[model samples]
Target: MKNEKCGGAATPRWFGYALQSLVYLAHHAENDVRCPSGEIATKVCTEATLMRRILARLARANIVEAREGRDGGYFLRKPPETITLAEVYRALEMTEPLCTGLMDTASDGMIGMEIKGAFSGIMKETEQLMMTLLEKRTVADLVKEVYEVKK
Candidate 1:
């Protein structure tokens, strides 16, 4: 669960599902191993419908490709090494960050404005740091980490 929220409204779980789907695909990335949504959903423990939506977003980002018809399925359009965690975040449209943004958006006068302004600055800085770190990590890097843990 990569996109776990700390507070505020809960984040859509699509990002985690998308990452897991990418990681799953990365392991079988070579030679264009296309797999159906059912199979991927089964492996990732998510609904097929949600997986389809997530995969559609990834495909739109050129991270994955989809084929139609009976033999149709999904395959990585780009190599795992070229796919960064930041790319996944971007693909999922996670521009608004989680955590840091406290207080409701009720606009409680001058004090509220000042508080929100400060929180906005902090949120931006925090999100920037997160993206910087994520940009350094790729799907291949994560796959390697998983293998290491398994060993």
Candidate 2:
């Protein structure tokens, strides 16, 4: 998926899509059913291609599994409660730093350069805090938060 820049940072659109797809999978996991990419995409308000790309990443991360043929699709590789949000975030393997554009502008002068360095450190700390919080939560937690008492 093309990285869409927003407010000087590339908005993590893929992350949001991945979370939606994962929660859907979690809800359906009770039946042990493999859901089609198209069905998940429809449910998540995204395109099948995008869903496939995101799921491919998740598959590599071992968060989900995929199959082929007439009745093939994707399913969770583990229980929702076992899949942490941090794992999901890391699965996307996002390359763009969240302060991309802002950093670019930081090349203006001496103060800009110093501020850029400071910003870089701040970003790193922020990410660490984010991961720590995410590590404490799982897909099941999110599913519960969204659906409340899962069906």
Candidate 3:
């Protein structure tokens, strides 16, 4: 018998939110001004706590910075064009796609080895493709695309 493990889905919810928030921040990065957290949450139609968590992650990645005090909020740490989507994706990617159980069987059967090799290859290829595509895109690019779509 061949035992094999499978990877998870394409992207997580946090990744989606981080991408969206990055685009939003890039669109306003030039202003070099902070917006209220509540306002930002409302703009994205997400809960403030959720937004805060995402912002904290971004801040830790040095993609954005947060300020304290009544007049403080959040701002981009660097120019939008300098921040690649790949970087943001990497920052929020906290889990591996495949589980280890696939190859954890007590008996190493011929079929199991073949399945593991094939699945590992596919997963590696998929990850590479995704990384390439994401690296080619920047926050500025996303913001521009959004503007064009609106018009």
Tens digits of per-residue lDDT for model 2 on 1-151?
Answer: 3333323221368788899999999988898889999999889887777778888889999999999988788999999999998898888887764446666777888899779888777778878888899899999998999898655
What does candidate 1's lDDT look like per residue over 28-108, in tens digits?
Answer: 776567888878988888767767877888888999999988888898898899999999888877545655346456258
- RMSD to native, candidate 3: 7.8
- lDDT by residue (tens digit), candidate 3, 59-108: 88999999989879888898888989888877765465423344454237
Q: Rate the local accuracy (lDDT) of all candidates.
A: 0.78, 0.83, 0.72
Better of 1 and 3 by lDDT: 1
Model 2 has an lDDT value of 0.83
Collision pairs in model 1: none
Worst 10 residues of 3 by lDDT: 1-10
Give residue 107's lDDT in candidate 1 (0 to 100). Answer: 58
Q: Evaluate model 3: give its TM-score.
A: 0.74
Residue 130 C-alpha lDDT in model 2:
84
Provide the lDDT at 76 for model 1.
89
As a TM-score, model 1 comes out at: 0.78
Pick the lDDT winner. Answer: 2
Q: How many backbone clashes can be found in candidate 2?
A: 0
TM-score winner: 2
Q: What lDDT does candidate 2 reach at residue 27?
A: 86
TM-score of each: 0.78, 0.83, 0.74
